[model samples]
Target: MPIQQSGKRLRVPWLRKLDENDLPVTLPVFMAYCMVAGSLRSWNRIGTKTIVTLVTGDDFYYPVFAEAARFFARQIWDGQSFHGNVLQWSDKNFRHEAEALRDERAILFAPLSYQIQDDDRLLSDAVVPLGPRTIRHAEAALRRARLPITGESVELLMTEPWSRLSRAFQDRRDPLQAIQRLRSLPKAIPPAEPEAASPPSTLGLTLSDTHGFGSGLIEWGHDLAKDIADYKAAIIPWRDVENGVLISGPPGVGKTMFASILANTCKIPIIYGSASRWQEAGALDEHLKAIRASFEEAIEKAPSILFIDEIDVFGSRGETDRNSAYMRAVITALLQLLDGFERREGVVVVGACNQPDLLDSAITRPGRLDRHIAVPLPDAEARRSILKHHSGVTLCSADYKVYEMATEGMTGADIERLVRDARRSARRQSERLNGDHIIRHLRPLIKLPKAYVHALAVHEAGHALVSHEVGYAHVADITISRWRVEGDYRALGCVEYDVAADRPRTRSFFENAIAVCVAGIAAEIEVFGSFSQGAAGDDAADLNRATELATAMERAFGMGHTLAVEKFSPDAFARMRASDPELRREIHNVLATELERARSIIRMQRDAHEALVTRLVDADQISGMEVDEIIRKHRRPTVSLAKPERRVAT
Candidate 1:
């Protein structure tokens, strides 16, 4: 029967013709077969068989089929011969033939398992066209028309296709019904696993293995699926372009891993390695040999990705000078290789660097690694997903409570390490992998001391307290305990501060500069009666910033009266170097005065300072309420500014 097209699906005939010209016989034979199939009689057992001459051993391959092939067989039964049935010619060249003859009658036959003679012309032929479904279903339809599985030809069904079709067909009560049932079956499901550790095949072998073919690694991200989609989208436009991408980010944030994931999404063969190791040898011969071999092996398959990780290890130097010959040679050869790579379809060069600033500048000039992106620290939601993914298939926990607890402020590497540690803890106790076990193990890692903890709370609270009290900056979570560290000193005491609305650290803020800088120190001094190094690092940074702001206020913005002249301090350090011997005394006195004023404000509101610190220390970490309570208790008379109108009325 004519293979009628109805949208994407095609109506199957009892048999499919192997050669094109057999349409003469095939057309009638298929019409009869369709009549039978369409009839109320039996759909099975109606196919015909006849003398199939063994022109050569290959002729026997024209096996019986269920739907399409059976129709063709029935047509041939009426003294019809077709060409392109893999006729083993005398020349022993087993190739597709353009034409075939049947019984002295000129009948055109396409080669069995044929190649299109001219793809353009064949595709343009309006008389016969195949949809993707019809063509892909062609073989299976032909298989159904063949002899039953119990027949002698069952040995031929042992092939992978045969096995697959057999498993699919074995369940059908009728061969005709099998076709419908088979197509209706769902696509095979992959094993459901939360975390799958790649095997030793992953060692030195950076390419991915998607089932059988080598591919790229899956990337790590907070939004794995979305970022993967974005990475894929970013590459879509450049797929045909002869350029590369430089995936850069902080260390342990998965640049190399992202490179692989991008390659995988591209559905191309990927070969990956680090440039740092290759350049160490300092010889071009070995380095270039490896790169050459990698390219040759990869190029045999046209669509491929070459991934070089830690590319900044080339060390920001002139190609001919500090860099090894191998470094220069690798970069040069890569340029040459990339320049010529586009001749092969679907090939790309992808690289990653932790420090783009450390890379030789030329590596990023357009053609080499053009798209620079940072795979930053995962946000809270991302952190949860990553933690869950790493946690394993069974998420016995109600929510991502433990994941959130364990992964705060952690990079992808740090998160993975925590998960591994959690799993290790579970393994040690032989306990069921669940949130309790994860939490119990993680609890000790994040615990810290009382005074130190209170100090942290007070310090951050001081920043937030003064900022909020003065209407300067916002603070998010003021944390006291080390929620993500192991010991007392290494404990993280932090105030996740908000971005200032007006970018207040500018030079013009110097009139109140010392106030902001010394607020934490002042708060520390007010609460504890003595200051420590808990906020010292911040102090130094703040001090330098304050001084710079002070100079800017005095000189640039004319906001300071102390300068009293137009001269700018040529060099800040030089001014210090050349200052009058007693300038140090005045400097200390000025800093002390600013700090004292900020602290005096705090001392008057001692209850507020204590309230904030005590609440944070007790809760270890508190949110908005801690902020509000501190503000409520810290009310004091400040000569600096008058109370608002409502407060005055109250």
Candidate 2:
């Protein structure tokens, strides 16, 4: 093979010789190359194929291919005749060069982002996808290039070479443009001044001031904070206490804020980290080092909160993909750092994520982030309270009721954003923050057609009437929005019910639950000619709930024909439903049976249903007490709405 450059003879003035420990390549980029080194070395040892494909996500990393090739030529091939180059799609001779590489022992950097045929000889099972680079890599690049590390310099690192100082390096044909535009920036940034003292009441952000339920985490934090402050070690030892919890929820539900509140309440320092942050340290060993450092720091500052956001990034050891090897090693190191030989007595770890199921089971096992709590979207009452806090002004009860209805299905963060945007709007107009200001952000409510409002009322009335009649659950209130709030339609209609926690998950119990779920569909058919698409929509839509419960009865709860239970997860159950015709039929049968049952219940209570619908249409909302009175006034003597039980053949 003809060598393009002899490593021993090729000398350059701009670049210096790198020592064994020195890495001229960015850590992440270097780590990527190191990933494929083993396979290449294995081939070298066996004297088999020598052409290896390095797949990259973009051309931004193209500049580093030469530095890597040069470094590896000396380090791995030991200055032996070596040739390496990127087979870019942009090159006119891409096909010719690719064909030429077939007879040569070389490393080819190829961009997979470009369209390429799979049958191409250069595409192989040994393809290595380029690893990602973060701001951490940018910092490392600066140090390697012997440039001053400043905020402005780091910004330049992220810019395209042609747009900045990198063009100078490119003009000189120098590929290592790690310095970027640093030469134009000040060598150092000046120190910042300290802030003024805050009021005693404003010690820090508190859970007390925050809205929405914490699923008992907030209460637990308060208790722990009190005990720690009082030094009640005898009454509640650290060993005996539940030290950690994993919180999961959709974004803006305050997973990160939960940690902040815990730190504030406990009056302890909070150390933040994530798997991505740890992995940014570079390879598996570097990731392990970062993980250990985080834990060690938390331990040093005892009685602290170590919040690991996006802990799901560690993934599970059960994964069988290529990155599984790295995942297993990182997860194992994390486990050790979390609960190893060294006693971490005073530090409490909290893990937060948007998806809890994606987390490694070991990470959430008994001794670590054991307790899992999912933060739900704020309900009406929660929405009201959240508005009050963010609005920073007292409003009449009626105003709050309107605000709550407008903001339904919104998370805490969503509500906060609404309020912030409303205030900004108000400021722009130089007017006082009023209902008009908030309404502007939410957009003016568009009144639904009279016929549609009447239908919605009847549908919601069905839920309340059936729920109250069943006596299995307590109907709190029922509401139907006369106008649809722009951008958000979830608050169109709702029936609030309180079911006892002790209620058994028996066949009869689930049947009644399913009946409540489908009552709207049944009610619409009874009152109107037919039901509309209103019953089937969002995940929380009535029809969806009925279908899920019906499916679970047969497939999961073992309440149907067979006692044999099949384990169910949201995804797994969905796949089963999609693939299995018999299972889908069974689920449909359950729904049909329950739908009929709901229709029968509603048919018997027609007078009460009419009265409820009249009240709902007139008021657009009604209390449970009013519904109870209406039901009592119109009840027939022979009617029974209690949960039905199966009877033996007589």
Model 1, 80-184: lDDT tens digits are: 443323222221121222332222211111223343345423322111211112222334334445423343233222222321243234211234334333333
> lDDT by residue for model 2 over 101-170, one digit each (tens)?
6545556556655555564444443555555544554565555555666886566554533212322232
Clashes of 1: 19
lDDT of each: 0.48, 0.67
Clashes of each: 19, 0
lDDT score for residue 321 of model 2: 50
Worst 10 residues of 2 by lDDT: 190-199
Error at 282, model 1, angstroms: 3.9
